[model samples]
Target chain A: MNGVKRLSAPLNEKQLLNLRAGDEVSIYGVIYTARDAAHKRIYEIIKNGDKMPFDPEGQIIYYVGPTPPRPGRVIGSAGPTTSCRMDKYTPLLLEKGIKAVIGKGKRSEEIKKSFIENGAVYLVALGGAGALLSRHIVRAEVIAFEDLGPEAIYKMEVEGFPAFVCYDLYGRDLFEEGIKKYRKE
Target chain B: MREVHWERISKAVAELFKKINYYLNEDVYNALKKSLEIEESPVGKRVLCQLLENAEIAAEERIPLCQDTGIAVVFISLGQEVIIKGKNLEDAVNIGVAEGYSEGYLRKSVVRDPIKRINTGNNTPAIIHTEIIPGDKIKITVSAKGGGSENMSAMSMLSPAAGSEGIIDFVLETVKRAGPNPCPPIIVGVGVGGNFELAPLLAKKALLRPLNEKNEDEFWRNMEDILLQKINSLGIGPQGFGGRITALKVSIETFPCHIASLPVAVNIDCHCHRHWTIEI
Candidate 1:
């Protein structure tokens, strides 16, 4: 096992791919938060030739739907939701120059391929670790679709936000490799 | 007949919402801790470690275990002899749900319609299933079901000839297909026998049981062991990182069904497994 790294956020695509499973990384800086609804909206925007809510180039998208914060808190229980649900919209985002995605669970083959081809990476935060993750989010504000409730797009500033690289730019998936190594006869 | 105080029930229900959200039940917490010890894959073990730490932080900070606090699903067993005082039982339950989610700051994840997808702001109108049982006390089991795991649930009605082997295969296949999507290692609640909807209902009900608690019936006990072995063999592991334990536990609940039907339902619950029960 290698020691964890604390990289300032807004990391480039190549920087994200350098992260690997079992390697702890604390991210600092700006990240966009969105889930199924916002992903759909983003895709719709792309399909309609409309401008996106945020620039996708060199950006990291986090797949999350946080609970409403308590008084004085920035966000609530801000953990990653399952990533597979956003598979359909991911390739579209990658095409627009999105560098990385942060979420939990395995992605589809198409999404995995798109990451490799587009020089993007898929990072996985611990699912169900909402409270722990929320602690890292220093500030949060809705950037778009406030009416989507928790599923709305939010721009978040995080410090020491922990994540692991589930899929790297080199076309390797930690999930697949782990399964092969541990599968029972 | 025992008089049931609607106010008391509402209070209990209200607290049920917050408790289910803020705290990871002891069984689930302990199971996760155990998983960290037994998991063989380095990545899987690390994921489990993070999960255990997350539970502690969530409870101490009084925050939800997951961002998707999930739809409020309650199983109420009302004593037949109890009489509700002052309010309609259904309305009382809904009010409790609304108050709990709003006041507790839990996410309102429910939608008014699946198609139109209107947000029901306060997570009201809980999916309440009430059964009248012979007792003077009312029992309520609160389960905050995450969409990720609930979406992975599946049910099937096979020919009676397919039998237990078919039932086991169906459950294993469903989990394998789910892969990392449902957030393994998951707890699988299996309902055998019963009709179409009832089978799934039974499976969901079985989830209320503590993790790793074996069925008391000898026949069901053996079945549980076999299923547990088969599921772990899939190597889905924690967070699907892959390990020796794909499933923390498999609980089966059954009832006699129509002779022509061998209905089976598999209800998958993520590692969070947030649930709590209250008897009032």
Candidate 2:
């Protein structure tokens, strides 16, 4: 309910520390997009000790598979997919030095542990709000796995992209607190 | 016999795809507005507001409400006296889906094979369910089902003695387990009293009912009312962040079944809930 915080990508520890589970923030700067299939491929590539497409250090990855842009638009309706599908491969990405993730839904306990250990956080973009979310993305291009169509990883430049910190580095989870606060006997 | 051309059906299906995807249904839209008015949590209220805005933007810009344009699911009520004049109903529907998706610039979300994981390219081969009815007209209902909510759907065959309380528990448990994954403020469609497969089918059919509509049977109407309240009480809330208004509606359709079986299924639909019907 307070003023919306503005944060830049490749977020630092101080920034991550400042955020709480329910704080709303609008992200700016570059973020990477990847979803179910791309995460699997990322897992295999990392397992084989191959070079990743981009530097993971201090980066934020958005779990999205955007629709194709109509003629003149930078991108189509880009929104967060469910985060759980990418849970299996998330630890590997966090271990590689990713700073934060933007998605929807709760993460696994293992993922929560990794967030604390790796100094990362999880953010949630409103699900089923694609058309509104797309308004924040200013530029987009496929950065890897072009053959996967919508599943391809894209590098996106976003301005004022709204998200809520769902799982924080301090082990506070908004999802858990949320249920407790709202459920009336 | 009343004769109709397959091409006409295909063209109508194509338009249905274009219109349904671009605009949210009035009943669903109004239900969300009402949820926005009554939602308690600030975050939950914000989510509902965004959903309404998203629906408006999608409609004004002619864009999809969600990127997951969904799998094409069709329910057809064909009159016994109606004769198709062209190729076939199923083929025509597939062609329409392909054209509508491509021409309207909707995302093709379907895969050609589930295991191999190949993109179907055109979002074709719709899941068509047909029932032969008594009249000379054809009625078609089209729903574009996104994978998220569809994946959370569940079915169970309970002993007749498990009874009503068992059903209440099962439905609540299914929803509680789903949490935010199915995109709460969801629509829960429940099927009761049918055999295993038919129960799930009926559950899916229940979703096709208008959000503002309730079951005609007094017993089922009361069941819908209670289920809707209990689901919201779970505090899953909008986008599962917790608040009032977790589900917009709960619909239950039933069928007579064998004395030994009481099959129940829950089919969840996200708040986006897209579908349309046409009679020809």
Question: Quick one: best lDDT, which candidate?
Answer: 2
> All candidates: CA RMSD in angstroms?
1.5, 1.1
Model 2: residues with Cα > 4 Å off, grouped in runs: none
TM-score of 1: 0.97
Tens digit of per-residue lDDT, candidate 1, span B59-107: 8989888888888898889999899999988888888888899888899
What TM-score does each model's chain B reach against the true chain B?
Answer: 0.97, 0.98
lDDT of each: 0.86, 0.90
Q: Write the per-residue lDDT of candidate 1 for residues A1-185, one digit (tens) a residue.
A: 47777766566645765766556677888999889899998899999999999887788899998999989889999988888889888888988988888998887788888988988778888878888889899999999999999999999999989887778767778888877877777
TM-score of predicted model 2?
Answer: 0.98
